[model samples]
Target: MPAVQETVDQVRRIDVDQYKYGFETKIESEKAPKGLSEDIVRFISSKKDEPAWMLEWRLEAYRRWLTMREPTWARVDYPKIDYQDYYYYSAPKRKPTLKSLDEVDPEILETYKKLGIPLREQEILAGVVREDGSTPSRVAVDAVFDSVSVATTFKEELKKAGVIFMPISEAIREHPDLVKKYLGSVVPVTDNFFATLNSAVFSDGSFVYVPPGVRCPMELSTYFRINERNTGQFERTLIIADKGSYVSYLEGCTAPMRDENQLHAAVVELIAHDDAEIKYSTVQNWYPGDAEGKGGIYNFVTKRGDCRGARSKISWTQVETGSAITWKYPSCILRGDNSRGEFYSIAISNGRQQVDSGTKMIHLGKNTTSRIISKGIAAGRSQNTYRGLVTAHRKASGARNFTNCDSLLVGDKCGAHTVPYLEAKNSSAVFEHEATTSKISEEMLFYCRQRGLSAEEATALVVNGFVRDVLQQLPMEFAVEAQKLISISLEGSVG
Candidate 1:
């Protein structure tokens, strides 16, 4: 018994040490007074030098947020949040405009380096870093620190392809006409409580516009890091793919460990025109607190995509492994004939983490089609829930929908639940739903152990097999990171 106890202790110690991206970046910042108010919204808009119309839009959203209440319909529990106790905005002090990557703050560069971001290679044409620190061919990156965009790489290359990729703040000023045309077209300001808040106070996020008939030259990505304490992050992302165009965008997030719970509410909207397609992927790894759930991020986000023209398509892929409480539903609206939508997700809840997430597909036009694949893994004393909806309207003749939700358990102390709502108002709509729940088989573990594999290794092998379908949907680079994160999250979860 003593030997077994000691082995368990060692496994736990390793599991607790797996949060590799929890280090803080020490940089001075300018912060707004801690609280939510009209003044704060105005201050954020002023900082960005937004136009009067944009400010009015933000104020209108704020007015709507005031009349709304924080939603409590999810199957998760956490302490109440004091909306007045957090800094609505925080940003690193502005530095002189940068002419090249070398001019970026060394501290900022070091932060990305420690996070495993290939900044040097990404800036060059070749994806390799030579001995002299110059190479080529890598994805473009926009790094967001707290509430502002710090730097964007490969912008010149993307610009040559007629792609407009920049920070949302810059987009608001430089391309106001484009921003005005599609900013709230998909997700209205009145979308939800948190989204309304984000609409009003969102500081900075990525913006991408693919020109007509052009395929993006390379993948555009963003990395968001939250460093300031007592502050909330509200970033808004807008992506538009013009007719016959294509683009793939990826986002990643992390935060420093803190004992006090922080808030993150974001809004993302994607628009795909006729014959165009958009692929959006996210790998979220926020701090999930300690074993006792003392402090972590409370992530409440709203993400939606719109297929507004015939033959348009949009897909969302996400790997969620952290956050004390997560509530998000990335949805798609198929509003044009023959449009398509897809959602692929993998959610992991360890320690005291709680996740209430899924996707929604709304079919409103003839011949629309949609598919959803979701996998949830629960370990320790955590809770994982998959809540999703699929609706076909009266005009959605010949629409088709398919949904599959699967849950895996790592220990006896965890819980997994699925809630799927399907509604079809059109008699011609075709729908299918499949769900399954399973636990790690002792026989499987025994077989792997007999092959000289450790318990953690065996568990990860099984999990990877279970989630292979969704993982394959991610891009190659993101898939590697997602796999490593899955293995680390499941470590020490099994005996």
Candidate 2:
């Protein structure tokens, strides 16, 4: 019994240590005055060198935000956030624009190296070898430190394929027409509270454009890091896949361990034109606070995709493993005939974490289709909820929708809930819904132990299998990291 207990302790410690990216980068930053105000919003726009029209857009959003209230509809419970208490803008001190990987700051390069995200395309393609000498597949990455994009790898390679992949800040200056045409087209500035706030002060995120008939040669990705103390991160991502084009984009985020909670509000918009397809995947691993939930991040984000032309498709896959509180619903608007939308998610909460997430699919065109698969895992004293909606309008003749929500509870103190809403005005629309909740079975554990697996191993194995369906939807590089996160998140559930 003593030996078994010792093994359990060892496994828990190792699992906690797997969050190697949860460390701060010691870099100087220029921060705006702490708080939310008209001046602060203007300051952010001025700092970004945005055009006057853009500033007006932000001010409009700010005005709308003032009239709006923090939504309490989510099942998550957290202390009231002091909007004016944190720095709304923080960027690394002036540094030379990197012309090549060799010109990048060695410290920044080393930071990603530690996170297992290689900045060198050659090294990434050759494969990133772990300390154990195992190699993970190659991936291009845009590293965002605090509120700014520092470097984007494989830009030249992507350019040759007629893909435009760069920081949103750069896109605003180089391709204002494209930015103006679609910025907020999917999620308008009047959308919601958090999104309005983000629009007013968002610093930096990725911008991707896949030209017509050109499938992206490789996956494009962004790695966002938060380092400045008492600073809120507001990043905006915009992706436009032109007619007959295809692109898969991935996002990863992390923050240092802290005792005080930080705020992160972001907005992501995706546009798919006729016959185009876009796949977006995210692995969110921000610090989830200590065991007592003293410190962590409040993640509030608005993500939506618009299928504007016939036969377009957009899919969102996310694995939420961290954050003290998470409130997000990546949605889709199928406005074109025969368009399709999909949402696959795996939300795991442990150590007092709270997650309120799901998706919304609005079918407005003829014969549109949508699918939703959600898996929620709750351990320790955490709470996980799945909230979703599927709406088919009167014009959406022959529309079809299917939804499946599954929850897994690992301990008695944890909780899981599913809330789904469906609305169909069209008689021809077909909607199917299913849900199930289950606990780790003693029989399964006993069988695994008989097969020589430890209690902790058996529990982790079962949880992994439960989420295998959605995990398989993640990009290969992200899948590996997410698997580790799942195993680590379930550490203390077994006796």
The Cα local distance difference test for each model comes to 0.89, 0.89
lDDT for position 70 in model 2? 95
Superposed model 1: Cα runs more than 4 Å off: 1-17, 121-123, 126-137
Runs with alpha carbons beyond 4 Å of true place in candidate 2: 1-19, 125-136
Residue 122's lDDT in candidate 2: 74
What is every candidate's alpha-carbon RMSD to the true fold?
Answer: 4.2, 3.4
Return the TM-score for each candidate structure: 0.95, 0.95
RMSD of 1: 4.2
User: lDDT, candidate 1, residue 152?
Assistant: 88
Clashing pairs in 1: 125-136, 125-137, 126-136, 126-137, 127-136, 127-137
Worst 10 residues of 2 by lDDT: 1-10
TM-score, structure 1 vs. true: 0.95
Query: What C-alpha lDDT, on a 0 to 100 scale, does residue 399 get in candidate 1?
Result: 94
Error of 2 at 299 (Å): 0.6
* Candidate 2 lDDT over residue span 329-361, tens digit each: 999999999999999999999888999999999
